[model samples]
Target: MGVLVWNELSRYVSLTASAYAVWASFWGMFFRKFFWDFVGGILRNPGGIQCVHISPISWAFVLMSRRPSPRARVFITVIVKVPFIQIMTTIVGFFILALEWPLRPVKGTRFHRSIPLRIFLLAFQAILALLFYQGTNASLWSLIAAVFYIRALTLGESIGPWKEQRGTVGQV
Candidate 1:
């Protein structure tokens, strides 16, 4: 039970982290000038600026522009450069992870074993990918983060359940 909980938690974290990375990339690009100005202002003089009239948009851009950890940045950079990572992430997240491995149907299950559902998932993933495939560094990084998130989900699912089952077998 502990392992299962941990597995689920890790999956949620991965998904969240990746989603954030993608969102940050998009946000940073869209508000490039504002983000930089905000960051520079914060760094140059942390408490010097009086609250004259700052817009919520400016505040959001500042918050979004904060630098990520070095390891995370490197990981995102490397993952984005790879070609197949995006496709794999989409497939894993939408098809395998989302459906909880319905291809190998478990006993006593009825509704989850539909081929059409899987097909729809695949189509949805493809469409999403197409929509986001603007040739930009930010988009690439977003893809990389998405892949990491989905891969984490896959790993958590594969390892966590197995460990739980093994523990139960041992007890029995």
Candidate 2:
């Protein structure tokens, strides 16, 4: 029974990791698009006032309203549209996704689990999305990515020890 549960848990973890990676990559693409567009716009018109309200939401609107440069378009296409790059990104992202799970809590203590490091990381990522992407969609997607990552981590923690124990028992 334990072995069966462990096998199911492993499958679940792999699926979850792949899904999280794909989702994160989607947000990453959004972030890249907005960031490149903002850079291209600023480079084209350095002194132009981008926003009237000067708030985060306003800035996002302003960025969304701008036209992307040809260079920016090509860059986005190469990174996001190219088939090979997409596959490689998904592969790399899976590992990146897997790594984030262990950072949330320590192995054996309740106090260590009190503070989730992923929340701080999420905040930092949100700030980057706000500053560079400056788009509502990008921010929202990043938030979703954070939520999915947290869920994946929580599920992994709940199931991981069972798998390890099952492995040891089989070895014995």
Candidate 3:
């Protein structure tokens, strides 16, 4: 029963994460504004700017920007919301959701964590994603999804020190 509950919870986490990737990728600045409004209370702390646990893609922005200031956050926050980036993210999110459906049964198991299996799943999904999204912007987006999805699955959901928001989609 505990295992069943754990699997269900992981499934919800996967669903929420995939939805967030789609919404954040598609909505652009509107999603940022919505995010700020929802988390406004937390950002109000005078001591330090709070780092939001968000999409792994957003963390890439943070690392690439490489500045430890609020300006970096502002820049990343805005950049990530760009329509092009958002659309790509949405595409990747869709792929994640599609792949996730099959993973529901094995979630939270060591079998799910096996490197060989992960490679196989990623290869299968990437091929399908490439074919599914071909002749469109998603062609490039599939590459991005391949990297992020593998990292998300292999490294765990925490992109860095920030929190991993499993429910960002539902909240937004």
Best by TM-score: 3
User: By lDDT, who's the top model here?
Assistant: 2
Rate residue 165 of model 1 by lDDT. Answer: 31
Report the Cα lDDT for candidate 1. Answer: 0.36
lDDT of 2 at 109: 41
lDDT of 3 by residue, 35-123 (tens): 33222322222323344444676554231112234544553343333334345456656655654554555554555444344344434
Per-residue error for 15 in candidate 1, Å, reads: 0.5
lDDT of 2 at 70: 74
lDDT of candidates 1 onward, in order:
0.36, 0.43, 0.41
Q: What is the lDDT of residue 9 in candidate 2?
A: 41
Models 1 onward score TM values of: 0.25, 0.30, 0.31
Residue ranges of candidate 3 with Cα displaced over 4 Å: 1-5, 29-82, 102-172
For model 2, how does the per-residue alpha-carbon lDDT over 50-97 read when each residue is reduced to its tens digit?
A: 422245654543332344467666544654344333344455444334
Error of 3 at 9 (Å): 2.2
Error of 3 at 107 (Å): 14
How are the candidates ranked when ordered by TM-score, highest leading? 3, 2, 1
- Evaluated at residue 89, the lDDT of candidate 3 is 50
| Per-residue error (Å), model 2, residue 92 | 15
lDDT tens string, model 1, 34-106?
Answer: 2222222322123332222345765532322344334433323323333233444344344434343324444
